[model samples]
Target: MWDKERRSVATVFATHGAASGTFASRLPWLSDHLQLSAGKLGIALLMTSIGAITTMPFAGRAVARFGTGTVARTLICVNVAVLVAAAWMPSLLTLAACTIVMGAVAGTSDMAMNAQGILVEKRLGRSIMSGLHGTWSTGVLVAAMAGSLAAHQHIDARVHFAIAAAVLAVAVTWGTRSFRTTAADVGLAAEKKEDVPLFVIPRGVILLIGLVGFCGIYAEVASQDWSSVYMHRVLHGDEAEAAFTTGMFAFTMAAGRLSGDAVVGRLGAATTVRACGVLGALGGILVIAARSPLPAVAGFMLIGIGVSVVVPLAFAAAGHAGPNPTMGVAGVATIAYGAGMAAPGIIGGVADLTSLRVAFCAVAVLAGMVALGGGLLGRNAPAALHGAEPVRVAEAEVLATEG
Candidate 1:
């Protein structure tokens, strides 16, 4: 059982994370191939967000109906196919259409995988979400490294995407096959008795978590979409070297998340997230000010490290937000990812209206929101869910035993 759960956690993260890396690293090239202006590019990107938002409401129900393992395995393959197809899309219209389907396919599968990770975390009775999330960062890191080298070598986008699809497909297939039986597969029979919305706007405590999650997602997606463009266009970086921006960001993000469990254990979620917010802000500022590619790389790395654990913490909170972890996760994902995707549209408009640096200033403000949003978890109710307890409680139990 333990082994199966471990495999579920690892493979589920790999499928989407790797694909995200592939897409992000290749986005500038995709845009160039389509001959898109900044505004047109934003519109294209918005279509993907639209598809994801529409599909997320069904995420909870799918996990309840089909089981997380099956859902994750099936949709992950679909996501890979979309990436492959995207490389060959001939027109802006076709790529926009492809992104919509791609977003929907990837979003639902990611939701299921997250559900699986939560279930496993519950059984282990420790904080594994951060580590599971770290695996996702590792996937992104690997994809970015591969894609960077490919782009630097002037590899055709279609050939590059095809190679990535084949690699991820094999790894995901093998990984999913190793899955252990999970509670998600067992069923949500009793959970059906309660009234739950297919999609919700998150209220009260959960709303705060969702907003912070939004900030995290906003920073991440905005960076993914624009950071490379910023370097290539603004700093006059070599097209090949521009690919390294996403790679650098993903590398630091993976590094931070891989070590996140230890940091969270020591500082707890609230304090840890606050620190990350600070890092994100500083990183954004550095990127805005840096005149050269190397400095921009350093800035991106800082942003990566700072924003690394925000979503993991948000997902951890969402997992315990209500009786049905799936519903809560779905609700928060709706708010965060939905809003996160929307920001880039406005940013694209702004970029067209002014400059990319100005658009990124908007991103820095969102990062500040992450810092301020950390206070919402001040009550630390979620900590109890992860099995944290006071030292005094242990002392009391010991003294009672002595008595």
Candidate 2:
């Protein structure tokens, strides 16, 4: 019984997830096709992060100028093209170039779609962000599975990407029709009056919120990338057991997100986030202290559920924290994405220096930070930002930073 606009925006989220997941699931093939050494491939892959971080600063401006629907729809389609181009690249250099464009388009579209989701949540006057994010996770899972199947069939990566591009392009174009701008969404455009900078570094409350999101994303990224390795290496689990541990984490994460709106509705965002932080911290502790595989598996599952809704709620908070919803979202996204990219390396470095248990202590500390900082998100928000209209950035805040 969802409305057209809400359904359409969800479609946008799903399609974007699918596009990114499709590329991700086929990366092994891509590396082999280009005959890249592991070291060279890592460098090529780093281009995606470089591209995303470099261009994210302008995403808010793009959305303001072009409208959320236009930017989201166009960039998602472009991302598909970039994926196809990447699949067909002749050499490591070409692949790196293609990945950079892939990341830029994908990151901008992500910010734009998030802005649109906030708009939809505003119009609906209830919690939907978590559900939208869950839909995105579902899209990623499904696309990844499909890519695995295609790879199993030995389908050429070139054909695989081209077909995926054609299908995803059509889906995104049709899905974004309702996301187009109208008079109602013009409030986001109103920020132009303040001479807002193209890229406003998050300050004060926004930065605090971003840091809260960072803690959550750090836990999430660390768990997603390292849980299986931890299982096999630290817990001495078999390969199947290690894979199962990863799957368990993914399942709980998706389940938690899908059910998070109801939880937020009942407990309120602030309380839910605080509880999530504590739970995540507890999970991190269990991981650090576990000497057996079962404890570690349970710990990862807890971490999954603990952090599932944190990012969605953070974005929701961001939309209301600043005069420009898009900018607020972009600022938060920039911080959160940086955390995602950094978590793996940081954890690995710590593990190299000491042990995986020691590396996970970092996750525990950050999760504890989330618990302490959780109050900042809700202190200024009214009614937990549920059904609240976007507010003007505080005059003091604007003067302190935007000036």
Candidate 3:
């Protein structure tokens, strides 16, 4: 059972990783094919983010009704189809439509997988969530490398996407059989009833954690989406160098997450979180103040390391807070993702009004706040107030006995 569960989680991670990789590789092709100006491209990308925000809450509900596995498989299929269509389509309207559809599917998959991970962590009786997320980072690494290779070989975006889709299809096939049904876990239902509020409101510690997550995700998104542009436009880097900047950030992030569990185990969540926040803030400051490309790239790497564990830690904290951890996680995730979508555009708008350098400096200020907020969160410890019955142990025992 454990093996099956492990494999199932791994498959989902791989699918997401591959898709992200393929998407990054295909962006240049997308730009060239559509002849999109930077402004137009930004607008189109914003639509995709809007689709994600619009669909994620609904996806959480779907996971509540249908099973995580069902939703995951369905969304993967949809993602593949939409991505393929988007790859082939040359028209801006068609591309926008396809990108929105892909975003919706991706959002659904994201919710379902995390909900599933929550369940899996309950069963395994230890911290597997970070490792699962690490797998996602690993997947992105592989995908980026693979996509770059394909591009270098002159493979068209359509062919690359088709290949990625094939890989996802195989993974989905293997994962579905081991997928847990909602009916399989009565305890989770009871817990949900107990933990979830009648009115969905973010308050107390959960709200604090969500805000922290918001800052972490905002920093991450900024680096992922804009670092390359910054390198190219501000630092006068070539396309290859710009791409390398993004890749290095992702690589370091993956490394941090892969090792995050150990750090958490050694330092405990409170201390680990505070330390990471400080590191991230410092990294952001360094990046903003950097005069040359090398320093900027180094700053991004530091940012990656600092922000790496924030999301997983936040999710774990959220799950531990409420009896119905899925609801808690979903709520926090919704806020965090919404923040992520808004970060780039907000930063871009600020950049347009002022300068890109100033915009990044603003981000640094926010990152410092995030770090301090994380420390404040540690001091308050709302996870304790949610009725400290050793939730992790109780949840694990329930899974073991139920299974």
Candidate 4:
């Protein structure tokens, strides 16, 4: 049963990852095919992000009522349908509209899968969230590679998305049955009959955690959506080199998450987060200040490594923060995601007004703030505050008996 559940979780992660990769990979082609100027493309892309933010809160409700399997399957189908529409659209406006729909589906799928992952982690009683996220990164890498290969072979973007959709469809079909039928409560409520609070406004510690996530996500989204363009246009790197920068970011992020559990266990979440934030800040600064493309690319790698563990740690903190873990998790995630969605447009506007390099420097400042915030947060919460009273108690008893 455990094996089956793990497999299902892995499948969902992979499917969502592939979908994200396909969307990202198709963007360059979409821009060229539609003859979109950079500013116009930026505005159009904002619609997709708006769609995601608008839909994510509702996705939480859907998961509460319909179950993760149903939500995942339905959203996956909707995503494919939207991709098809996007592929066939003749005008930039039409494509932008399709992008909005695609974003909605993608956002819903992300929430459902994350909710499912949290549940699975509870049942297994260990740290699986980072690993599940790593799988998503793996899928993104695979799709990016596939898209690159197909483009090199002179394959059309539509065909590439279609094939990617087919892969996701198969994954959804196979993993549908193993998804949890009931939502898993992570000791959030005292009674089984109590439904998880769907609309609690996060306060106190939850709010702080959400802010941490907001900063981290803002940095990450900026990198994901703009780093390639920055590399190509600002650094004068070739197409492949530009793509490699994004790939390197993704790769380092995945590597960080894959190894995060051990690091978190050894260093503790507070210390680890502080370190990551500092590293990310340094990386962002490096990207902004680098003289050559190689250093800029290396900066991306540093940012990836630094920001990798922030989200998972934030999520874990949210889960452990309040009595209703789901609501807390949802609140933080929703805020973080909303912030993430807005970041690109904000940065794009900044670039329009100033320069891309200056805009990235601003992002570096934000990343530095995040690091400072993490340190402050760590001081307030500490390891003793992470709901680990029993460990303290056990240690106390051992000391007393030994004495």
What overall lDDT goes with each candidate model? 0.77, 0.74, 0.69, 0.70
- Clashing residue pairs for model 4: none
Question: How displaced is residue 284 in candidate 2, in Å?
Answer: 4.7
Candidate 1 C-alpha lDDT tens digits along 1-403: 4556576668669667999888878777887998888778887788878988999878887877766767878888888898999888898888888888887888788777776766655545556677778889888878877877888888988999998888888777777764433353433224552254655566887777888899998998888767777788788886667778888888888888888877877787778788988999999999889888888889888888888888877877787666676776777788787668776677778889998888889767788788888865444334533337421234454345235
**Which candidate leads the pack in TM-score?**
1
TM-score (all chains, Cα) for each model: 0.91, 0.79, 0.85, 0.86
Question: What is the descending lDDT order?
Answer: 1, 2, 4, 3
lDDT (tens digit, per residue) of candidate 3 on 131-191: 7777777776677666656666778879888888888778776776677744236345443
Q: How close to the true structure is residue 58 of candidate 1, measured as C-alpha lDDT?
A: 82
Q: Is candidate 2 or candidate 4 better by lDDT?
A: 2
Winner of 2 and 3 under lDDT: 2
User: How much RMSD separates candidate 3 from the native structure?
Assistant: 4.0
Could you say which candidate leads in lDDT? 1
RMSD of each: 5.2, 6.8, 4.0, 5.9
- TM-score, ranked from best to worst: 1, 4, 3, 2
Q: How well is each residue in 27-84 modelled by candidate 2, as lDDT tens digits?
A: 5566557765444655565576677778887888788788888998899999999888
Error of 4 at 364 (Å): 1.6
